[model samples]
Target: MAGGIFVVPLLTLFAGASFPTAVAVSLVSVIACSCASAPQFLSARLVNLRLAAVLELATVAGSVVGVLLVGSIAPGILYGLFAVVLLVSAAQMLRPRRSAQPLGSGWGERLRLASSAPDAGGVDQRYHVGSLPIGLSLMFGAGTLSALLGIGSGVLKIPAMDAALRLPLKVSSATANLMIGVTATGTAAAYLILGKVDLVLAGPVVLGSVLGAVLGARAMVRVNGSVLRVAFVLVLAALAVPMGLTAFGIEIGPLR
Candidate 1:
């Protein structure tokens, strides 16, 4: 999830990779990581398949448009846009979660988005989905950013699901994990066809990211959801600062 934030910068600044190449590698790594983590989430029944599928339609379409625009934008502008996205995501994550309300008759209920899951205490908890339009809009933006910046876009998806769609934090995270691979694959296909992906660099990144994601999935089961949200915000803030600097043509040493 956080891979694209740091990986693109490190690869560009130290490894001398172009923005497009770094983004291509990041998309590949994100796909690998999502693939590694999603099965465990599915087995745990944390993933919301119905919701993921619905949102993916918007995300995939947005990703194709984003990939097409990447070549027209300047690198510095892209960095600035990425930094702004990170900061917005951090702000969203820091906002207090609203209580889930009763499901009203609308797109949410029509799609059967309300569901139950076992909480940490092993009790069933019911959650109602809200604001499908808002969630879909954000998912579209997330997809665009994912392709444009070489990210998994979980930073955007988690907040959209949790804040806008009224999903449980754990559910949002797990569902985001499950959806990221499919989202990245949409953009990765474009990059692959353009020959932007560097197989040598992407190979190691994919392997390491998959291993890390497996470990992260295990840890998610043990960690409190509030703690996970806090950790995510901190990571976004940390990455955002350096990216903000780079957007102004300031150079920081390699993160590695």
Candidate 2:
């Protein structure tokens, strides 16, 4: 799951396994991501409980629905949608994010649902006010994508928080990492019930992902993501073409 989202799911596909095998392997990666990023999220004070709670509501709801719909939908249709999402994500990552400004005048309505939290810099900052509906909708979308693709929506979540909700990249990334495990819980249940998981293939992927997540989290603090974002976009673009072809039932490969 971790490598698929971070790099590409193509490797797992090359292993000649079913979709369940890929999701099962990806779940381990999700666990590792949570374990690796939770500490930093706590230390940075970016948990945003209210926002997470609201988002979870939507995510859980959507995941349940997604599971129900999975059996009815064609695999090609699902993969085709995922390929589109991947391309959009790649584009979003490549562009520079607009800076977030404080919501000053809109403080009254927001104060009821929104709250203040300190950043790693020790300043209490204002977050979304009265935006639960919008946030929940976003999470619902994330959950749908998760169930459909077997990839965590962290890529989408981070960008949404940073771009749509006006959150700092650091806080957004931290919060996104924190939320993945919870979101996965809902979808994983659905996947499990549907028999869409493989233990053996999942084991090594999870092990490698946890170790990799720890390194990725640490690197997030020191590295300038500008270059990384560009490279990631290029990688995503390259992957999208083949994914699109595959989704349309045009087989285009021999092996990884």
Candidate 3:
């Protein structure tokens, strides 16, 4: 979730990589992380394959569009947009969620968009999917952001599934994890065609991210959803300010 948001900035500010190179490397790392973690989520039955496939169509289209736009947009403008996205995600994470209502009659109902998972008590808990259009719209944006900024886009995907589609946090997270590799593959192809990907840098990043993701996926099953939300908020808030400043060409002492 956070890899690209932090890694791109660190690479550019400290490691002296160009923005495009950093972005490409970040996408590579995201793909590695997704590849490592998603299988485990799939084995655990946490990933919603149907939901992921449905949303991926929109995401892929948006990623193509974003990749086309990347060359035309200025790096500073991209950074500013990234900051805005991070801030919005932070606010969304901080917001309290209501108990999701049943999947009332709609496209979701017609599609049989309900799922079940075992709860803490070992009883099957059923949840319904809602707001298909809204979720798809947000997913498109998430895909665009993922391509434009070189992220996994979990920041947007999680909120879209949780808030718009009325999915449980764990399901949303796992599904997002599964979807990211596919999404990044599309963007990475574009980057490779553009000669933006730095294999030297991406090599180490991919290895580290894959290992970290495996550990994180195991930890995720044990953490409370509320704790995850708080951590998401804090991480995004911390990234947003520095990125917003960087966008305006302001360098805080030593970080530049």
Q: How much is 109 displaced in model 2, in angstroms?
A: 5.1
What C-alpha lDDT, on a 0 to 100 scale, does residue 221 get in candidate 2?
A: 62
TM-score of each: 0.90, 0.85, 0.91
Better of 1 and 2 by lDDT: 1
The candidate maximizing TM-score is: 3
Error of 1 at 28 (Å): 0.5
lDDT score, candidate 2: 0.66
- The lDDT for every candidate, in the order shown, is 0.82, 0.66, 0.81
Residue-wise C-alpha lDDT for candidate 2, range 130-248, written one tens digit per residue: 33445566778887777666667765676567655666656666666777777777766655677766766666777777777778777876787788878878877777776677778
Candidate 2: where is the Cα deviation over 4 Å? 1-8, 102-130, 193-195
Flag regions of model 1 displaced more than 4 Å. 223-235, 253-256
Candidate 3: global Cα-lDDT? Answer: 0.81
Which candidate wins on lDDT? 1
Which candidate would rank higher by lDDT, 1 or 3? 1
| Pairs clashing within candidate 1 | none
Model 3, residue 138: distance off in Å is 0.9
Worst 10 residues of 1 by lDDT: 96-105
Q: How far is candidate 2 from the true structure (C-alpha RMSD, Å)?
A: 2.9
Q: Give residue 246's lDDT in candidate 3 (0 to 100).
A: 86
